[model samples]
Target chain A: MNPEESLKFSYYPGCSVATTAAESNHSLMQVCRLLGLDLQELEDWNCCGSSSAYSVDPELGFNLSARNLSLAPGDRPLLVMCPRCLHHLRHTHLEMQQDPRKRRAQERRWGRPISPDLEIVHFLEALIRFGLDRLKKGAARNLNGLKFVPYYGCTLFRPPALRRQKYYQAEVENILTALGGVAVTRTYNQRCCGSFLSAVKPELVTSLVNDIIGSAVAAGADCLVTTCAMCQLNLEVRCTAAKRLPIFHFSEILALALGAKDCQGWFIRHLVNPRPLLKDRGLLGPPRLGQVP
Target chain B: MNSQPMPAKTTEVINISELDHHFATEVDRRSQADLKRCYQCRTCGNGCPFVEAMDYPPYGVIRLVQFGMRQKALECATIWVCVSCHTCSSQCPNSIDIAAIMDTLRSMALEERAVIGNKEILAFHLEVLHSIERYGRTHKLGIMLRHKLLTGQWFKDVDVGLRMLTKRKLDLVASKVRAMDEINRLFLPYWRVKPR
Candidate 1:
């Protein structure tokens, strides 16, 4: 239990983090590395079936998540980034734990033993468990009193399926406040980001996103930070409000505070362009040559 | 903005003979939620963020299931419109897990070939599943392109699409799982074999 010793975790970055929210993935990696956490990507891991698989075929979604569980080595906790992925994985695990017959059938299907005792921890929980002191020691930059709303995007602690488990109500605020950022508590932090509706019903999602961003702006916050990558994407892409605040993935701000240097690449991927806000707060340096303004 | 008219409450008389008495039991078994405990407090409906878009509020859908109105429960736009954000479930005084009930109702709708209340939403989901089936992981750019083709709304979100492309948010190549056969076998269930 040495604080400085790197803790090993099998990381599962769901679809959004891998592609649409790669900046989150990049920043998460940067933050983890800075905090001396070793994240080994789960090998040959497939989709958790996302909301679609479960929506169309629940059994398919169950098996898809079970496959990822079977792949994880039981020795260490499996780390998940996406809130939806974490829910699906943990729900599947809970189901398997309740029904031995189902677990045995899945184990036979994959030809690998599914460990019932494997701990599935979200990145936020892992940071709280192992990285607080490390965060204190590794603080490389002041947050300049940057005010941000901790938007959990409806899935982190709301799902009834996992209600008995950990509730991450103020974990984001605690971590960021420790880093010198101010947490704005009056905004719509847990509002739905219109998940898939952002694509099918853009107008509806536009209004919802506008309401969320509008509330944040009204709360006198500098920006919004979210733990879920999909929330980050939906908030950025669907906002049609006359006033918009840049949405930062929790990892981006965490990485910036920990002195991650290659953040220009992450900032360029944002549609809202958080550079001005970062520059105003003095969290980011002045634009370098060839950097996007 | 595309909200449907609120469902007629009392204009439609309930024909008890037409009720499928076993529908509620089936949903209860599948979802493992205590639907019978819902006292119609409307706490769920009140807390639902997307209730404006749904024809029936969360409790109204529960009532449909309770009344054994199978077709109404399965074919209602509320089930499809729900993104399973669990706002209702969390706020429900009865702890009924309303979102799980919606999930069960959606799957049952697909299984029974009931008319889908929202075809576009179902189409978007199918595109995502198809991408997962092929790559073992969802490919955002591919899902979006194919979804546009299926819905034939290619020009609707073209600006957002272009913006994402410029930001390099969409990866051209999907990250695939190394074990393709194992991932493929999960889709062998006949119902899912034919991607709609």
Candidate 2:
């Protein structure tokens, strides 16, 4: 275990994580243990004020993220599982730095105003921080033959002003290599899958998601891996059994490579079955007593 | 944003006003995009996924914004239907964040009680905000039920919901964050965004 990877960091799981994506949360926790990483949940951390916040009131979004920023102790760089959280935090930081007047207002309002220079550690960045070389060498099992088309969705590497630069998408491919898997780069990977629209406009979401998944199928990917939980759910919900390829959170696959047993139990939460594919490929390990695969 | 043919246009003399000019400035201030920098290239309209559904496609909305046509722009479903995907921004030769500008426009529309072209999307956004205000995270099942009731679209995704319930993908229970008061403090202001 690398001593540097053992560094403790503030963790924010966002909202959907605790509720809808329990499997992702559990797998991520297990993977952290395997990597010798320490993740302490932010005490009384509020929502990052996702898409809904920004849509309702521009100022409200920044304020919501600012509240969390003030709550975040200076002990470690804040870690966020959701890319939307990463986007909101970075936006909040930049907006605060740009507007001193608003900063003062926030300070007076929060009573714990912070000159927040804390680095945001997105989950993908943390995986790379674990050192791709060490991860590949450390893998007890290799998903060598599996094809992964790493999906960035939006927010992570789009709208140039938000993301630091053109970084996360390429690092995702690198992480895929570290897992001893083939990353399909020849097709559409960075396109948005009509995220929140899955709730309001299912038809539009279906079409956009189809365009994304269609490109991956054409590129011969065995499975699609995503960083955003919203994207994971959208892709899975949009994909029918005919077009269904297991859309996995990056943490889920990382947990597998990090030697967490009972991948079946971890994936039981998925509506679209990933077990048949993983099991057929001889990756789920020998069947257990009472295991139904 | 792209180098392709644009949607068909209809000829109608656009009227601009003092208030309309002010509307453009407000949008530019809020979104930080120089509306004058746009060349009417129709690039953003070309790559937008929801263009077919939009009342005024991306470039059309930008043109309306440039002309300070606030009512015309807000009345169109284009702003609300945008998924904020940034495809247009990425393809912009002038480096304009059309998507971000769209975001600003939506917020302004909400603040003003302006004509929102998509009632369902606004309702959905409101429901989600309502959840986040109370629980600090969106309650998915709550949003679905509320949206269906609000939209009167019963039996929508019911089978999918059943499958999800069986799979335990949907959490029937809800939990609020420890700091509900703090969350409310952040939210109460936004709820009354409309003019007093």
Candidate 3:
């Protein structure tokens, strides 16, 4: 694929980004638009059988994910933002590839061709493949040496089933650094953020989230930029530490650096308001009268 | 005879006849993880973030499975506590997919109607699935409300819930897929209609 040409992808926002992390979705669209990446939202995409479906019933999980695959247009690669969604979609795709009978059965069920060769790529991977040159050329506002821990959460690249596939360990650092952000490595960057347990067992999640935030604060980082929207929510909502750092969806920072004007809308949604930190670093202007300070 | 009494026995003896010898094979087949390859190095347990909350560590659960302790393995809290973060599997020297095995055990436990090790977590998952079944997408507010109602923990996490609502993070209305029939059919095979 040509770096200069606009890349088209079928975007799968997943459930979290669609609802709870709407700001992330907004910022993601902003970033993609600035980069000239044309994202067509996957038509009528359903939930990817989140951790819940897979936990109680493996067959339900498989079928749930298979339906999303059936909906993907064979012409373009499916671009997913959430790591868990990416994992399930890609894992289901791999399973279908290995078992032709299952693939055919699902295809027949959906009355759509489940493409054997459809490429499932994460947004980060898509950026690496086609946006690096665009990022360097189209960067409007530098990151102002903003120090952030590139928190990939746990599911981004750690799953054993997808081990042999693409490894995205340093991709966040690579992209953010190119935009002038300083990457903080001396922290618990890849720690699990307690996932859905944040909902049921808030105490447990609070302790775990505190540990993660404490590590980041001790490491002297300004904020955490995460690839997963779920991690962003968990970290923001579950932390009970004395001092808290703002958690950013990776696309928010990317969109900010690209000179997105609607940043207030995005920053306002954060539990730990990032406006003050952004202002302190000269990344954002002083708030207007009556605006969130 | 010596006057000193024998120390109280701390270990429980397992009756070999009760062990399900095919349990390991069933898990292996479902999870696609080679349980036989696991030598109990304890790496998975050591790396698990939530191991401290579990009744048995990841390795201990694997040991139970290896020993065909089906009832013990199925009812363990480790499976429910695990969020499938894959930290254990990634750190395993033998490359055992310990998270996958945990997922399989959780499913088996649900299927066999074993006592749920963590009912609250299971309740949360059920609410999430229920939300998906209704709207074809998860409604965070709905899931939380239903979960709270089911667990009868209305006051717990109320502050965070309200905070999320104030921040407009939790959508009141869920986004739905246009193809509801397509999604509902997928859930038909396994989802038993439970009174909400």
Candidate 4:
């Protein structure tokens, strides 16, 4: 596939994106259609093990993620929507290539000769690779003056040297600007939101997410946009009402600007819905009075 | 028997340089992180979310490893408490991966049969693994329920759990993955390697 002019790639919608952040999945679907991006989800893919595997069993984490890569078709680079999933897949890819023992284990499990040739790219990477000029020209509605803090919660950019080449450090900011949204620079963008440990230690997550969201709110962001599903979840479930920062998936903002009309269900799914802010800004129409169900 | 070695008297001139010499090597072998590369710069702890909660901060963990304080580094609640954020790894001037070290410590604790300080968090990890073992995915509610039952934290997160359920975030039932047996096979090595 041509790297520059191509939009088609196999999509791996990580676990959280399907359940907790289903809105992200909905918005991503709409955005892909509007932008002419072809995202075919990998068939029969399993979990990437996330932080759970890394924190508990290193071996399980590697094998579980490698299993997914093994299942991916080599024809197209696997485009992942979640940063955690992207990191795990990519990290395991690196490990399996470098470690002879792990490489042997991976090849044996899959019953074939494996290759690190499986390219794993994050949504941000794909969008950035998709070209910003096209995004600006293709936007159906301008998100001008809509201040957004691009909250990159680890994964994609962290462990910097490993991710340095593949990821553009300012890619999220670039995407927001291209879509006509003002990216808040002063806000704490690249920080960890305690990720999945939020389930076990909500208090710790609350403090961490509070600081990240507070920075955005203080910087006058209308909403904090994130590419990570876990970051959105942590901010939604942990942050206090006083924080008043509605967490949004980057797909939601782009999908809206691309004129996604259906998916009121997606908007309502947010713990603190972004519609009121969008409606107030004239970026989105008023909520329709329709059936509750 | 206590796992720790006897501490030398403060009044005596203690030549402890040779003591715990193998600590750094053992941690290095497991973590694939060179503990000696750490220069006591607390950059990792500065960015750590759990530093206040940890007995020894990120740099302190490496320092402990450097001094061969295995009991100090491995038996504490910090390993369980760490979110594996990799903030330390990213910021480390030496490129020392603190997250990997934390995982290594957790594995060491489990292997050594050390008394874990944070049973609640431990229970949560075990329950999640158990759920994955059965369904081949981390069944969130099932893991939550099992964790609550195991830890007796029934009242914990009930409000949030209820809210998620009402919001339809929780998929109460899901079809088991067809290759669950394959996942089970993966766990076989984990079960057999334990000396106990």
lDDT per residue (tens digit) for residues B77-176 in model 2: 8888887778888888997888778888888787788878898888998898888887877788898888899899988888878877887877888667
lDDT of 4 by residue, B1-196 (tens): 0022223455854358645778789889977777779988777777776676676677767777787877777788778888766788888898877777888899888888888967777777777677767777767778778778877879988988887787777788853567666677778875664342
lDDT of 3 by residue, A45-136 (tens): 99999999999887888998999999898878899999999999999999999999999999998889999988999988778877576686
For the predicted complex of model 4, DockQ is: 0.47
> lDDT of candidate 3?
0.87
Model 3 chain A weakest lDDT span, ten residues long: A284-293
Quote the TM-score that chain A achieves in each candidate.
0.95, 0.91, 0.95, 0.90
DockQ of each: 0.82, 0.65, 0.72, 0.47
Looking at the true structure's interface, with contacts defined as alpha carbon pairs within 8 Å between chains A and B, what fraction does model 3 recover?
Answer: 0.89
Best by lDDT: 1
Pull out the clashing pairs in model 1: none
What candidate 1 gets wrong by more than 4 Å, as runs, is: A1-6, A286-293, B1-10, B189-196
On DockQ, the leading prediction is: 1
TM-score of 1: 0.95
Answer with 3 or 4, whichever has the higher lDDT.
3
Off by over 4 Å in 3: A2-6, A285-293, B1-9, B189-196
For model 4, the chain A TM-score is 0.90
lDDT of each: 0.88, 0.78, 0.87, 0.76
